[model samples]
Target: MHEARSASVPVETRAADYLQAASMTAPLLGSGSQETPAVNTYNSACGELTVLLRSSEGGRLWNHPVTLTGNNSTYHLRLEPASHAVWTPNYFTSFELEQQIKEKLIRKENIHKGVGGALVGVRKVNPPEKFAPPRGITAAVTATLDFHGKDATLALRRPAKQPTATVEGKTRPLAANFSAPMSYYQPPGNLMFVGLLGGFNATKYPAPTGLYFMQPYDPDRIPLVFVHGLFSTPFTWVQTINGLQADPEIRKHYQFWIFAYPTGNPILYSALRLREELAKADQLYPNHKPYIVVGHSMGGMLTN
Candidate 1:
């Protein structure tokens, strides 16, 4: 006999409550034909709730952190084959939860036998805390996809396009993937932090000079370069870039970039460095799109 595998996900509060309520209606499945009692575990010691189902022989089945969907009272859960479990809410009475599991098992067997094309790149799992959404999108929508076949092709199904806007006497598709404001600025290193606070000389402590992209660089689009003032890192442009990204027109046409340098550097020297970086980028991409440079505090002089 094959041992059952398990998959665990963090159960969100709303889904957890719905699961607990549904479990009271029916017990979970176990090995053989016996039905196993449903036990809800709440870890008050750590102020956490643990919801899981076990088989009749005391083997574990479905773990919490599963996805639940439906209206207030009706809920349906979908778990991976490892857990080998299925659940139905109190409303799905004609087919009891146990019967539903049996049907699901049959379906799984059919799937494993190559019944239908596999649904690849369909992500229901959430990412780690460091990687959250609405901040920045690094990859194209298709980047989330994975495939076992080289011949596999992805079809992007999108809703109807939104209205368009007129630019330069021509109507164009509006750029509409706008996200809520995120703080992309804010000096990341201790050196930059101390430079802002006090005790800083460019000669003594040279700030690494480089062109940093605040967003993914699109060569086809115009560039909007932001230069921060004395004692401030690229983080000084955080709010400014946020404002620009929030605007639909600006987001559609320009990519945001920031220049970071030790604040103690002389204005002329810093500006020379900025000019060199800009020239380098132009040579690399060779796109003649418009360039918009904005400067803050002493940065205003660099812009000149």
Candidate 2:
């Protein structure tokens, strides 16, 4: 509420619109919040959510890429069904890390990239009036596979700007996850252990000493860099990042990034590293929006 009234937040309007559209669209999709539970599976049968996720270390979401997810989608259809994904949040220290390595360790995909999910509708193609529905695969089919990934992201951000989909001859708001990539991003680690590890041995579990994006780097949205304190790693801010992004206002306008450095290093050296990284980013993304750097504890000194 406070942000909506504040003019300084550049994304207030778009964020407000997304929230409004979501409220109106959720009930229609039959995937309402905990408070407004789905009436029954029958209602949700009209639509089903397929989360598209990238493979984690030593694991893959599937054996191979299947139809309806990647480049195979057809845009001419208007209602393109897309795949959905999730990155489960895992910030708490995994006690196992301390046992095997006997050292606080940060284990992540290391490489952050890949597709999100999609919400598609599946309904009976043949009318129910047909008392004698045909067996086999003739009774029901995938009614529509609307939008997915980035395509869905833009539509929900500014609902009015894009064309609405017609489902069952009725216009409907394109269903999508308001917060992509971030909402599903789950980085597994013990923050305290990893932080101390980095602070103790710069080389063993060193953090990338540059601007690392939590999501795809959006040129339009301003960059918000989070720096962790002494004996801390970017994992320290995972929950904080998740919470901030839950709000449409912040998610729409500001892309989150992190400045990770081995806390064991001298503060002056780390600050210089940050300055150099910012300069490089500016060069790469010319005419980009101003940046907002946030620091905690020792991180505060680096920002200053």
User: Please, what are the lDDT tens digits per residue for candidate 2 over residues 153-183?
Assistant: 1110121122134432345433333222332
Which pairs of residues collide in candidate 1?
A: 9-65, 11-65, 186-235
lDDT of 1: 0.37
lDDT of each: 0.37, 0.42
Pick the lDDT winner: 2
Report lDDT (Cα) of residue 128, candidate 1: 19
TM agreement with the true structure for every prediction:
0.43, 0.50
